[model samples]
Target: MQKCIFRFIRPQDWFAAINLKDAYVHVSILPHHRPFLWFAFEGRSYQYKVLPFRLSLLPRVFTKVTEAALVPTREQGIGEPPSAALGGGRPSPGFALSRPSLKVLCRPDTKLCFLKSTVNASVLLFLDEGYVKMYLKGRPITMYMPRDLVDTYCLEAKADLPPKKLKLDWVYGYRGRDCRSNLYLLPTGETVYFIASVVVLYNVDEQLQRHYTGHTDDIKCLTVHPDKITIATGQVAGTSSDGKQLAPHVRVWDSVSLNTLHILGTGFFDRALVCLSFSKSVRTNSNVCFCEKKKNRFLFSCVFMPFLSLPSQCSNESVFAADFHPTDANIIVTCGKSHLYFWSLEKGSLVKKQGLFEKQEKPKFVLCVTFSENGDAITGDSSGNILVWGKGSNRISLAIQGAHEASVFALCMLRNGTLVSGGKDRKLISWDENYQKIQAVPELYGPIRTVAEGRGETVLIGTTKNYVLQGSLDGEFIPITQGHTDELWGLTVHPLKHQFLTCGHDKHVCLWDSASHRPIWTKTLEDAAQSAGFHPSGATVAIGTQTGRWLVLDTESKDLVTVHTDGNEQLSVMRFSPDGNFLAIGSHDNYIYIYAVAENGKKYSRVGKCSGHSSFITHLDWSVDSQYLVSNSGDYEILYWIPSVCKQVVSVETTRDIEWATFTCILGFHIFGLWPDGSDGTDINAVCSSNAKKLLITGDDFGKVHLFSFPCSQSRAPCHIYGGHSSHVTNVNFLNDDSQLISTGGKDMSVMQWRVV
Candidate 1:
């Protein structure tokens, strides 16, 4: 059916009449605008006018409708509240309108900061200026800057931020007022960070004051007293002082108090005190002095009676060598250039003197003199001959001639009465009791400076050419195995087996098998190797390398098992304990390292380190029982160590310029010690045994061998000198039957066999 609907619409400020005929009419209105409607009537016309809200609309506006009836617009206002007529329109029954409100809409961009590709930033330090900027994957994060970086960042970060940006995810500030100079960054926890700074200041003057300002020279020799309260210094000429220097002075002072104790200087010509030594028995209160005479060019040793006023007497113009008897505190022996003399401290007179072989073309200058294992006198001379005089009247018992072609630099007597000698002419000789040369090996490319024998036939020879030779007693001189690339200063043979060790300028410890003539192993020491030897058992080898690194190596494996000590200025010698448990390493740094070796399944480990020597360790040896270890260094003192107590047992000063020293069992109760005497000039070497036997041996720089003997057993006695070699004698060895002796040296490079004829 056809429908008619009446609707009231508010347009601006007036009401409207609308009719719906066949279809419903849709109408819409807005604030302050006219109303709009659409109807489906065939023909219809409506008029609307703007009026005030109080005005009412007239009806019958749809009279022209054709197919539908019409309804007046005023009828639709019936449901309106009274307020509808006011300016505020309330509500209609069909729809309600609320107050108008404001709402805002926004869209934000998500761009992040970027980092510069060319400039990479590192966290040097954290400081107070600004946060440290770090870019991760083109995102920036800030870290607290270190104090040192604050000043630097202030100057560097002044430019505008780079086009590439960084994303900042975190930041932290510096704390405290003090600024650090150096910075280190570390992780605080799992994800946090921390910074550490270190400050430094330089002081140049203090370092210079400590090393340069000294009394005189390079301070070659220094000796400290038993209490360590006093220090004695020996100054050589041409050092810190003038070259024409003579009679070098000895100064004593309190080490801690720095107070001067005493000064000893000579009035007789400006003669340098070449060597000095203190007594091992602290109660003795006396020191020995060895001086070189300039006129006749001789060596003399004086007891230096400090408490007594009587002037010391010169034994003889021929006196060239002397030393205190190791066991006796008052007795001393001197070997003259032509004769040997014995002196008694208690008697204050020359006990007995013996004249050497007078048959030589000229008075044979006694090159070296020493005591044998039985307290008998032994001597070598310029004629390349070795003489031994014991209890047998005034006649010489043993003589070895033609020991070496050049002057004999060193001589060592083994426990089995075998004499080992080296000389200037690059020759090594082994001798027998009758002074017969048993084996003459000429493997050294330079002058043989030293020779040592191990337990068996192994012999160790050191040369001036920075190399060492290990050979057998069968006249087979093994070629040098190149390990130390510098001049070899010293060498020592193992007390037990065919193994021997050496040290040189290269600062390396090298182990060699004399039988194989090959280097079994080598170790690089911080300092140069001066001397080394194997322990009594041949298991551990002690090495005295430069820089004071006294080390012990396992002979079988050549492993650096232990560093006995360090911080030495120079190390000179090393020796092992007879029992093969302890090692002694000596350094030019004026200290010795005594260490114990622990074995674990063929590996040796250093378990202890000891220090005792006060200068470079020049010589070293161990007792047969291994209870005592002896060492000599630049301080011109011999030190004895007792490993059981881990302390120094005894220290003796052998006042002679000890080039080398060793211990050997000769007689039933006698152990002999041998060393070089006289400076680099004459080949006056000496040998002595604990039994007090003395001998005189002379040699020239060209390798000569001489032999002589003394009668006294308890005192340092003199012996008769005998001439043999045309040149210096380097080595001496006793025969198997003890009747003949063998000698070798430089001039002819041949080992000579001698007898007691």
Candidate 2:
């Protein structure tokens, strides 16, 4: 089965983007293919009720469904019902067919009209060769971003390129809709966007994992060191200090640690240039600012950062670009405001300085710089010229003039000895050894601010705005970006489909299709969601928040069905039982509250509360039979509770209700309130048990996962100790087969999936 790229459908195609929502999932999975998609983990076996990932001919199957879906809308003015789950399960919400059935496939610039709106089929779809050879600036081209990105950054594309239609001649039977969709109608044929290609490359994958996210502020500049083991990032400046604004900070981070190894910037430079003072009378120091009847003083401390230039009253340009030495990662060159400063990375002190222009020449703001493979420095100046400087030299050895018509904003040295320079003129020119332009491309969206070498002949070009594209020497470009901007707090894989939901402190809950590794949709909440769990039947999702509020959301509509507010504290753990009758909420208030799921989980009522733990609850899980509740507390104690009677199960079988609410101390509490102490003081942050109800696993603060046999006491030793996580494990989950475990790192941003025997 062959598949057509959905994004390639021209604007004039049969329906708008709104119709194609979850187009493929609408195709019913054939009875025979369901068995091949079965997955088992931690002793739980699951079969895909809908189409799963990695299925052979998946695109073709989805395309067939799309073709069938569009036919009814085009011929009869209505869409056919989804055939995938007609008899039982819920069809994808994205595949909602309408009468005079208009289907919006993806999120375009605006909401597409459904039944109320109809597009004329008399208008034909335009064809683009899909790419342009090269282009110049002053001309704007619009690129059709991904189906759901809602991006329409009009970039100037295709300088000196002609308009050509994609002509296909088929003498035999033709099934594809490239030319036949609008046979009699002549398309408007406006150039939507221009693309380029090199090395006979195909289309962009769009789902590659390449984003490096951590910084909260914008990245003013960055440099990959010569060793390729370290990267230095200069951030956009933060808040002002002492009534005076400071430059952005520079952070050096090792590839191994992924953390800032050192910080350097404006703290050292403005020592004596400016002393901002308020009207005050002080006795301790004149530099201090304070006011009082007798004497008042406010003190300020000044610490110097190494190698930063002493800012004079006249010059205060921020350093936006830097480059590491060709042979040594320790040596770096920084250029800003016409001055080139060389510095030692180890000592953080200036080694030398060279002026970009002559003594009488006006100062030119140097915006970008790079190092050639041969140890020569190449800098792009504001004058649209490329200046080449030799080692230990103050004068320019070679200058490439008339390289660009405007300010040269970026420079990159490709591995093939070709020098690439981009400027505000929208021209990306590649120069040979003699500095003559071999090829020029002006099909960029904005002014190129910086360029870094990527895989092979490709280079990562960043615009002045928040966009970066992977461009090849031959001019093909692919955008590599992010899906999430913060650390993930919880992850839940759907039991029925190839989808999962991830929540983060960023207050965003993102749903992703595991097969494509692409985000489906992201919904932002008012408060941070600490935990997310899908119902046993995968129809609804339960979310617990830091504000002690729990929500039951319809999985399809993502609409809140009900909400229950508990004791005002963080509800870190929310779990739905296998039978979907009870919801367990673990809170920081040292209490595990139970809610009886009713009306098919539309609303929940508090049934009972199991309190008595000395410390806050860290993690909780329901027993396989849904009779017992097991929870781990911060004080390294695991407790068992009988939810039916709202009581703790101890050896003594206490019949009386123990009101420990008034007893604040642990020693004064009743013996039945506490279970056997677990973990020997090793803080357990995450815990889970096997489906067989035999083995219990706990991930502790010591970076170890311990497995213990059930029905044991404090004197029992763990049956096994597995170590893998480098930091404290924040979450632990058992797979369906009960043979493997999934653990998430606290700070590493990695989810480890491995087997533990």
Candidate 3:
């Protein structure tokens, strides 16, 4: 140690050093031997699944593993096994490690440093095991090799593929509040939907999802072609983050190939495309009908017909749905706003006739329309009635009264003449040719928005609360996708397990399992939630509301233990001290409320308030010893405080070197390089550091999550960026083990989970 220290005493000498990420975790304890590492912590029994850092045997185990991995390289004259410290005879300016293995190769002109190994079969085996244990729970450290280095060092390179890089594992949430028919049931057993701009096709039985990311703005409506594989989806008009105009448009694509077949209406549609449908009669050249928000204008075009808008008398009435006659290609039926119109194609112009109610009472609206096997028009109305119209009369011939308890929203005719109807009553009902109710499914999670037939007696339903459910006539329904109904903000990770908690503007607090990518439990509060944190013991969680009310709930029982209000404004962030003795609540009123925790986090008492910021408090972190705090505010202020005295540290140098228990303040000196090349102060919304202190992640206003090296000091620091959210990313959190990350979207109402690959 003395010799190594003396070698670096000369100020003129330059040196480089590297620290292995998650070093001790690479060493695993055998299943039977794992029990030997067991201990009691806060009345809970725990055992190490991997070699703990403080274990006495960790050094020898790590060294043996490193040596075994570098044995193959040693034969090629690599200098030596990695040493605890290195001292060079001469001054060295810089060094590079072509290979990550711990074999040290020093020449007169170059010196390679030690780092985590990504080569050799033994190291690969350890990584594979770690992947299983830490999968979807921690951020993974990924490394890449240049092509030339792979060919020179790894002879069997093609046969030995490197470990997969960390990537997005899953995206949560559904977009349904403002759109219609967003969910479609494909014949390939894939339920199709869109969140933000990306189209997602999910298979329920296999628990898999594939995405089609072709649109730039939020998708508004979607329809499946008659052939069942082709799909046409439309989007809203808006400007992207880079000032690019994302015009309203329709994209027709092949679902199996996921390739865009045709992009239509790039500059033609106005505001948004509200409805889309494909003609069934035109087999060779499929015709499409597009409804835009401009005075309910309807455009029709196909291979044989010119793109033209049909003339309408009630231009102010909103058209909810339009369909080509099942047997007549020249006839179109449109229904909306107390009016149903029939139009006939004639000499490049269209003639329309309004369907009259005659002696019957006129319904407020006709929500959806389908056709029977006999080509009779079947329409569902706002009064929960099904009206069968004659093809020739353009009038209602029969009315099935009170088919649903509330307004009917969707209708589908099965191949066997069975009609399925869904509505605001949250019921899915089947009717025979006689319009008699055959079966009624149990009430679902939300009001039904759309319905489509599946195999046999099964049906697929899209609900207002942003869920897709598949069920049989006998009422066994399973949710294929579920998401929040409003904007999401709060995110927190479990202390020990692969679980997390999220709360959002929808007034729902959800606990999710990273392994399954689904919610484990959900508790609803009276107000929307903005911030959340798990106690150190993992027994209780603290949730802060938009109205500044905060509550503590039992993690296991999900029962509210206690509740309190800090201020009238929102609680932006909440964090517990590393030692679990105190909780800090950051509020929009520019105050940090400190509370002393007792009885394992169920009880709390006011400690005091830290008040030094001029703007709203955005984020805060506790010092390692829980005696000091660092906080960021909306106005880009970074201040340190001694929470014990509720006083600010007047001297910045006194707290400059303090090691924080966690790193989350966006304006911290260590995270200065996380900002983009040209960014406003508010571009980044949230920041989190891995528990290992090796990685830092940021969620930004542009719907991006960036991963950077911890304490990124370089200007324009290089990082990995991922995007799935449609709106601003509100919060990001790394799990306790640093194996996974969770991000929430503000307007998209979505949660996404990422795995370190």
Candidate 4:
């Protein structure tokens, strides 16, 4: 066999290679283990099987070579060459090669998850290692893990929590202890709590500490001793020790133990007790003085001079006014209808008596009496005469005549020696030391209810018409302020501050600073404020409203704290206790409510209620000590309630109107002709009363002025009426001395000044 050799050749001519299927092919092999090919394909490997050569068409003879040629060799080796010759063997003319093989690898296992296409679906459950990972649009958002899975993925999320609850607290409460169904509480909480109910607890000690149930009806007046250990009470109308059914009697008791101490009556006389005064004297035989009177008759005086049951003397029927000597503390003085009496303090007997005004021409009756600062006395009569008496025997020092047109109601002494008087004629009159008229002012609209003197030469006047007037001592009438759109019910000046507070039907409290003549502030209440007062320090103000609501406000901040009463009746008046620890509110519900103001000033608690009044309560006043509360009711009675004992000490009926006659007249002609109409007449005047030295002043609606002095220990009347105004007298104010007065009225529509003398 001949060895085959491969060779490569370029195409010599394109036409010569076209049809030559079996033409010579050229192949080249690299230098190592060689094969010849027609093309130069680089870095490629292939495997092929050699086929046996065939000589069908070629005419040749060849030797078979078992080894492939490393390079073409023409000579044969000595012993192994050309040994065997196949019949007609020739090298294969051409060889075929295999094409290059290629293999490819791919990964198709990863996936992305998506929500199903349906409306209104929510996430339910999820599993870890699941094929699907949640995504919005081929972007991964969140992943869920099943409870049993332990996946390592961080979660970036937020959550919202639920809300909390509110809390509240309860304070103290109280129950009634008497038959009157009075309620009281002392709250210690900052916020006020609604009172759910009140129940009275039973006490085995049934004997009341203070008992005043003596009247056939309800007892009217009560007075407790200064020590708060003793109590005295009076009945309206009853039999005396001598079997006189029309006479009123009095009883004294040991308040703490409820023991009867003394019983006194108007012996054989059908008289009623109007007033009482106890002796604070430590000396033997010091008396307890009181006033008594018969119906439509004159007032008389009685003295239980000795605490023992010794014979006590009563003044004659002529006495009209009586009072215990304020300074003496032992001596008692009295005035008859037309006479006066001075009684011995220790003996329970009368010392001296005198008759001043004549009976025939003595106007109608003695109306009032009062004592001067120097122990001198003044008496007023219905004839408008004022009689002044010195300290000596029964001798008259001065006489003021024609002071008022009607009976005198009030009298007061000024800083100077002059006196002021107010009467039913609705006029105010001023008088000098000699009892001579100095100045007169007519009060228009309504009667003057009260007068107050202020510092720095100012005087304040309160009128029934619901207005307050201020003026200088030099007779300059300045209208200060007005309230209650309806009537001037009550007025009280701030005890320390130059400001004054007024309340009325307007349901508002107004404060006026006198120095600037400007209204400082005004507070409107939910109901009509009948009365208002400032705390002794003036830092807090207390107002009583008609809805039985009491409000205490911080004057500076105007923040209010309200104390609500059980009933919705009108609270007529209110007063702060002397020590400022308690507040007393009187209401038409016939109950006096006491509230204990907490020390921290955050809350108020009801202590107790004093309920003895049978009718609507109209007014109330507290003693310097808060232990005693005095109240006046529409029943024409005054009662003293002692808080410590939770009882009434003394009940006294001062006067009772003829209800039948007054009612019939009001019903019959109240709406009739102009002359008898209830409207105050054109000629009507204004009047005011004062406890200052027993002075009364009247200013007519027409501007007439009058002055009178009603002695606390003598009988006297209004002197005369002084005419001055062209129209009605609206208001009247008294200066230091009754010698100077101020008046305001209509027509002129301006305040007017007058000199009494």
Residue-wise C-alpha lDDT for candidate 4, range 116-182, written one tens digit per residue:
2111111111223221121111122122222222232211111111121111111111110101101
lDDT at residue 202 of model 3 (Cα atoms): 84
Off by over 4 Å in 3: 1-166, 281-284, 303-314, 438-444
lDDT of 2: 0.46
lDDT of 1: 0.39
What lDDT would candidate 3 get against the real structure? 0.72
Provide the overall lDDT of each model, using Cα atoms, as 2-decimal numbers.
0.39, 0.46, 0.72, 0.42
In order of listing, the candidates' clash counts read 147, 29, 10, 86
Model 3: per-residue Cα lDDT over 321-397, one tens digit each: 88888778888888888888887788987778888888667999999998888788988999999899987668789
Model 4, position 303, has a per-residue lDDT of 32
- TM-score for candidate 3: 0.75
Q: Is candidate 2 or candidate 4 better by lDDT?
A: 2
Best candidate, lDDT-wise?
Answer: 3
Badly placed stretches (over 4 Å) of model 4 are 1-484, 598-603, 651-716, 719-757
lDDT of 2 by residue, 166-227 (tens): 11110001111111000000012110100000000112343222122333232323333334
- For all predicted structures, in order, the TM-scores are 0.29, 0.43, 0.75, 0.28
Top TM-score model? 3
